[model samples]
Target chain A: MTRPVTSTDVARRAGVSQSAVSRAFSQGASIAPETRRKVLEAAAELNYRPNRIPAIMLSGRSRMVGVVVGGLSNPFYASTLECLATSLRAAGLQILLVHVDDALTLDSALDQLLSYRVDAVVTALAIGSQRAARMLSDLAIPVICFNSRLTGPWISTVVSNNHAAGLTAAQVFESCGVTRPAWLAGPVRNAASRARGHGFIAGVRANSARWPDGVLEMRGDDSYESGYDAIRRLLARGERPDGLFSSNDLMACGAMDALRQHGSLNCPDNVVMMGYDNIPQAGWHAYGLTSFDQQVDCLVDAATQLLDAALGPDGGPVSRTRVVDARLVTRRSTARLI
Target chain B: MTRPVTSTDVARRAGVSQSAVSRAFSQGASIAPETRRKVLEAAAELNYRPNRIPAIMLSGRSRMVGVVVGGLSNPFYASTLECLATSLRAAGLQILLVHVDDALTLDSALDQLLSYRVDAVVTALAIGSQRAARMLSDLAIPVICFNSRLTGPWISTVVSNNHAAGLTAAQVFESCGVTRPAWLAGPVRNAASRARGHGFIAGVRANSARWPDGVLEMRGDDSYESGYDAIRRLLARGERPDGLFSSNDLMACGAMDALRQHGSLNCPDNVVMMGYDNIPQAGWHAYGLTSFDQQVDCLVDAATQLLDAALGPDGGPVSRTRVVDARLVTRRSTARLI
Candidate 1:
């Protein structure tokens, strides 16, 4: 059997350097039109398709990753996605982004991504089923869950320290001498929210007998309107909660808008509000919302390391769940009372 | 030479149905662990690997597309990206997403995407230079320029009726009988911004002899802060334009917030404000912003059709530019003076 044509063969036929032939095939590379045309002609004659990534290269480095993410509406996820894409590209890997509209379809999304033979799969969407986790392991695919982590160590995960965030919010309110505090919660089913809420209750219980009852709880669907309506309902109860700890920043902003519009509350003065996910908008002069920064870079870094180890030789696919620390940003929303 | 092993061979060897064999390789596909392990063992015995797609298959039916987008911070692009991903999946194609932080790096971004051998590319970032356009066409790859059309027919494009959108805003102000209409423009270098601004000026010229001088124009970076600061600067001049048309919804929201906080101007009654890109916040009761809906689904459909034709057998890789109409959404932000 005859040997297959290669870039070097095409280079010889085109009478150009091997690098020039590679450059002609590369999208952003700048080779003269004449040289590129000659390379293309030579490649066509030799049936030398540049796109065919070799299997040896594929097993070692397909240079592609699948990232399934939901929560595009949240700036935090959007920003985090950008950071991951940049970081992945810096390491010569391209990203395939699959936005899971619903959690039910997450399995299928992963399936589709796997068909692409990606080097790794990172999901920002919550996937909790053991069966799904096992399937991924069966395929020996490297998997990393971002932001929200699962109960099992079947998949390596890197998440923000949501428990600490909740604790910080409770402490902020207690230190400000707030008599009544409310938890403006995000999607209750969300693990991140559950962690934050759990920590908040624990911290509050530690400080005052006001424990559970003192914690007025209201739910928001991570939308501005949800938070706005929730705050309006709480305020209509005659007296407003002296302190508010929102599960996410958007909800906190909406709550703040509601307070200023209806209760004429100018945070920290009339009410103190602490939010999770210190999105850039929270820093706006109008909001000045005190919140927590998830430290996306650190999370991305952890996930990157996990991926490297999983794909490395002698890899047992060591399982791990790493929780990076989060920092509380004190802004006007939760200013301490004088 | 022997025939290559196929899924049917794997299925026959494992005593499983063809569909089951396929499912084992697919994501989101459900199969019993015992059955899956059996199929895998059989495949290992046969040395069968379904993931190694040949170069011919890679170039022809890999069914993957690359989408490089910027301005995820802008909800419009974020929403557009989601729509494209869903539509592409419906057509059995996967998406490779690249977040271009700066327009300057777009060349390299496109290069990396091409290395994946995507069937096509969709870029929302403006491509102004002739060289960039030539490079894409030189690859003999199909490209769909989303949201903004370039100067040449080398690439297919779909854009919103930005100029008409400008005209609609101009007419809205005139119908409201505003004496001084101000334009809150986005980045001057952005083609979309230029199209909208040019259309607005022309629209005003058609309605009144006072033409140019009767209108006010201020620049914004299409951010909430830019709009807020621009409005504040206009207010500090001790003058208020009766009509305001912001290039984007975020900027428009910012402008409205600034007006209410500093200028004490009630929208529609004292000053009517119109925004482009009808983001979800525009419909919220707090803003009730009147804006233009770019009809993202329609745009996606147009680009999809273009891709189909370019890849079709009878298709000449035809290159055409299509602009769809955008409808005005009238809300409280632009109430008629009564």
Candidate 2:
């Protein structure tokens, strides 16, 4: 059998230096047309493809964008990927989706992205890991965080305002004449969760005197099952509040199920409820949920903007932060409350 | 603004040749430890990043897999992506997700994937165009079709037995004493839809005089609205079938809604209905849809196997087609019929 052809063989056949052969395959190279033709002919004959893994040695545009998200199962992240891909096509770029479930070890994933030499990196559902932030800063590549809590004067972030959105949910419940309210909080330690929880509590405190000292801060798991299980546990205690606020729509949907099953926990009639991240299911008549719209368009636009900045002409002194606003969409679930 | 530091500048600062600087950073290259140290230190001081994009010209392992799919609004593809990611992770690969809607040309998408030199292309919901198949064939990079049809043995494919699964549904209906059946199919000219339709008709005709002309084929979009509309249109004709088989669960759910509203379609009593793609919602009591499982593990395994062949040591001449088996999932939708 003939041995596999190598770049050296193509170089010899084309009568060009090894470096010239490499440059010929690299995008945006200034190789002469005749020389390029000769190199191409030789490569075709030998079945020699310029390997992309060693792209560090060449200079050209990869036309690949590295998209980093925290979760694939989360409907928010899933929908974000859908929108990002659409926007990317409009911009004539392709998305390389990377899921970093464990936020702390983003370095390895980043390294893989770097190896591919993608034009930029966009993160959705990023939980402000210091190591990840530092690595991204050091990489000096364009990085955009969608719905992440890395907002500052320097880093670019495209996320709905969790703080304000949470506040709006609380005000909606209060406006419905609810004297006593309970909170179904997300992970207590998560930055976005903390901000949202604080905002809601602040709103309820400002309007109502029946707010409990220890807001039923059941730590959320950001899943439908977790929401259902948590709410069931809370309802089992026999002290149900007049209103409830869930940090995410999944949990709220789960809470809806739990409320329906527990005869004592009536909703719309007795206890009004609201949630965040108005996912697709929120509009379903069965759920008829009221939640915060993370502004898919604004979020996607902000993410693309960060990517643009990351790949800007200068690629220097990147934007510190960008915050997109979230809006409250009241459906039947919260219609009575608002 | 000051000029951005280049690799040439790093070389000058490190007192080394440009090639030596390159060698120092190149993985697995024979470079002295001290030399590599000097190059790194100089690069940091000058804020220089080696032209990473050039690696696209270097080696075949871009470590990037292109995953093309359509209809993110559908939950099945969304869930498939989740599993595909895990499978790719185990192989130490990352995914580049490309979402193409109906209006766009898949060939254009393939062109984009080609330009990025993606290691392999895996399409979840679309088929590779003849032109793309030829292009990839000439390029020697495999284009693995996941849950699609393959006309020739040259291309690698991982797909479920839609035809057999359809037959399974018919058999269930027959055992349940159904004499007449109507089909709710996907869009016209879809290969998967056609296969299922043909198989269901064949199964119904076997061992029975029922359905002399086979089940009535009604075309609809693979969505809830289409399903609802198709069933409504069928019912308005003043003729009804004893059994219903929707090509997918979304449409089946919609059909159930229409039946409920019209007061003519009740599962196990008025008519027995079934769907395919066993989506999560099929289990809901509101819509207890019996369906067929696509066997996600087998589908993923087949794709992985094809990729292995394409990138294997033998350079791939033996493996091409793999068909995963589908199973009939008995649920309340068909329980009374059975």
True-vs-predicted CA distance for residue A292, candidate 1, Å: 0.8
Kindly list the per-residue Cα lDDT of model 2 for residues A181-246, writing each as its tens digit: 777777654566677898888887776455555355676777777777887888787767768888
lDDT of 2 at B264: 51
Residue by residue across B1-338, what tens digits does model 2's lDDT show? 44557778989999988887888767668888888899888976775666644454455466568878666566677777777777886786768787777421244565456445667777665454665555556555666776555423335777779899889888888877777788888886466777888889889878457657677779888887788889889899976877899988888888887787788568767788898878766765456688888877778888887887777675543337788888778887777743
Lowest summed lDDT over 10 consecutive residues: which window, candidate 1 chain B?
B103-112
Candidate 2 root-mean-square deviation in Å: 6.7
| Clashing residue pair totals per candidate (backbone < 3 A) | 1, 15
Model 2: share of real contacts kept: 0.36
How many Å off is the CA of A28 in candidate 1? 17
Off by over 4 Å in 1: A1-6, A13-49, A55-61, A103-108, A151-154, A209-213, A264-266, A336-338, B1-9, B13-52, B55-59, B103-108, B151-154, B209-212, B266-268, B336-338
Candidate 2 residue B195 C-alpha distance from true site, Å: 1.7
For candidate 2, what is the DockQ-based docking class?
A: acceptable
- DockQ values of all predictions: 0.41, 0.29
